[model samples]
Target: MTVAALAEVADVSAVEDRHVRLAGVTRVFGRPGTPKSVHALGPIDLDLRRGEFFSVVGPSGCGKSTLLDVLAGLSKPTEGTAEFEGRPIDGVPAGVGVVFQEDASFPWLTVADNVAFGLRRAGVDAAEIARRVDYAVGFMGLKAFAGAYPAQLSGGMRQRVCIARTLVMQPRLILLDEPFGALDQQTRLLMGDELLRLWRETSATVLLITHALDEAAMLSDRVGVMSARPGVFIDVVETGWEVERDSRIVSHHRFGDITGRLWEKLRTESLKHLRDG
Candidate 1:
């Protein structure tokens, strides 16, 4: 499908119970009066529904990371607004969790302590922090290794530890920026299944930024494709995958079709970025 057509569908489908809303949001960097200034991301309009799994796929350097940062309140938009649960996001909004491409685990801390770190910082009662930590550790299948440090775990297990830390915070929105990019393909797929299981168990609205087309198709209910730098959301493709989706979804016939459609839009923008550079 064409970008325009996909955007039209998105507009028509957007409803009232939005968990996150970005309206005409844009981000720019460099000195305002300088010729070197760069416009990094949108004047984009997008809505994420409560508990929805939304993935974003785009070419490298298409400002996908910038978009994720804006959503996480790590960076501010130069124009327009980013709202979370009906309030404007000013700075590090509460109940929002972010997982990056790098391993965020603190090697000095045990898995259970790491998961409880955020809660402890917030001055949550000791008993409540322990309870949440225990629940999150079990949820991520790290109960067996709760006392282990990050260095003792495999790459996938470390990522799970990172996720468990975020989960203990009970975030209403979770932002993942290429969280599996460092793993091997097999491990990446396994982590995807694990993520799906976690998503199903929580009420968090997830926004994942990934370059892997198949990963996006397998995990997302709707995938947004972005244009080259000064990035704008060009299209939103529906994967039509059920909420109970898993790695088995790669075997579904429609998976290829959705990924292909996303690539069609992404390829053009990617080439455009290369040429402009």
Candidate 2:
């Protein structure tokens, strides 16, 4: 199908499935009509189906993070619209969670307390908050370390805690900004498996931004590749992997081919940026 036709279908599906939708979204920094101004992103069109894991990949400075910021309502698009569940997202929308690359865990608080923080802030009752904290901590495999401080945990464990905090809120949509970027290769692969399990269990629509080609292919049902600055999605590739996918997804016959195609598009953009400079 044509790009416009696909987008039109996406809009129709968004209304019925309560998906996240972005139409002609653009983000610009600095003043318009000035040399200092930077057009960082868009006129990008995207639609994320409910319970689907979508990942965005591109070269550095390609506005991958900017796209996530706009979706999370952390920043508004300079032009166009971003909507969640058919409602325009003016600010941080309800039923959404975000996990950044940096450690978000509180040093002083134990894992359980850290997970419970959001519930407490939202005025969730004490008993329900306790219930959710227990569930999330256990689900993220932090049950044994529920009372342990952040400093005592390994990098992977600490990241799990951050994820648990987001999970406790039971968000319908999750935004991850290079959540595994800080980890070693082995740790990142292990965390990828854990994230896949969590995604399956929660059935939350996920939008992840990452520079890792393998990570994106392994974790996403559909992967969108963006251009270099003034980033717009140049193409979207479907992995065609089953929902049971994990780190071992690299073993799949088509994995290499899919990653190669993504790299072809992404590499050209990165080189273009260098040549232009």
Candidate 3:
């Protein structure tokens, strides 16, 4: 993921579509010379291919979530440009969905309603909304809890509801910032399996920001490593797992190899971040 590589990716016409593109993008807080200024991210060059599951891993406080925010159009770059499908992002683009680490399910809304919220807000007709909600809810294995409120669901189930809500929108690209971080290890494994299935059935490109190297290695077609703050891609490792990959892949020896590679890249950066404090 060098700047030269990024330029080549942006120019490649072999792939008729690129779900996301970034060139020298940077995000900074306050004036350039101000003492209070913080350089969160910079000169990031990336091209996320359509329908690929890509994960980003780095030390905590390395601006991973800031990268997600930029991609989701929740924040703009202070320099350079960010684009989705070749168009500059002035706001959250169409056909892009986002899910966060926090529980996003509405307390008052039942599982079905929570999943249907976005479509309803967009003025989709009741019939269409019902159809999409039923599919998303059932697909997420929440049909049994369709009538259950967020208060009644387990933590993992609540995250599933959030994902179902995102799935219902049928986004072409999904930005996930530690969407499974709150779940227990076993639950995270199960959720990871479901996410793979969702990606397959929906054909959506996924860009996930996560601290879990195992999760990233098992779930992504490629895993990007970021340096400590003012985060930039250091390397992108190919997992070589098939499209039908799941958490079970963790038992494979290659999983350890991939995970170790990610850790090696991150370890120094993480130590650097800690030492700086």
Tens digit of lDDT per residue, candidate 1, span 1-277?
9999999888766644688999999888986557998988888899899999999998888889998888888899988999998899999999899999999999999999999999999999999998999999998899999999999999899999999999999898999999999999999998999889888888689999998999999999999999988788889998887787799889889988998899999999989978987
Give per-residue CA lDDT, model 3, range 93-118, as digits (tens).
Answer: 99999999999899988889899999
Rank the models by TM-score, top first. 3, 2, 1
TM-score of each: 0.92, 0.93, 0.95
- lDDT by candidate, in order shown: 0.91, 0.92, 0.92
Clashing residue pairs in all predictions, respectively, total 0, 0, 0
Residue pairs of candidate 2 with colliding backbone atoms: none
Cα RMSD for candidates in order: 5.8, 4.0, 4.3
Report the number of backbone clashes for model 2: 0
Candidate 2: where is the Cα deviation over 4 Å? 1-14, 275-277
Residue-level lDDT tens digits of model 2 in 188-231? 99888988998999999999899899999888999999998999
lDDT of 2 at 138: 91
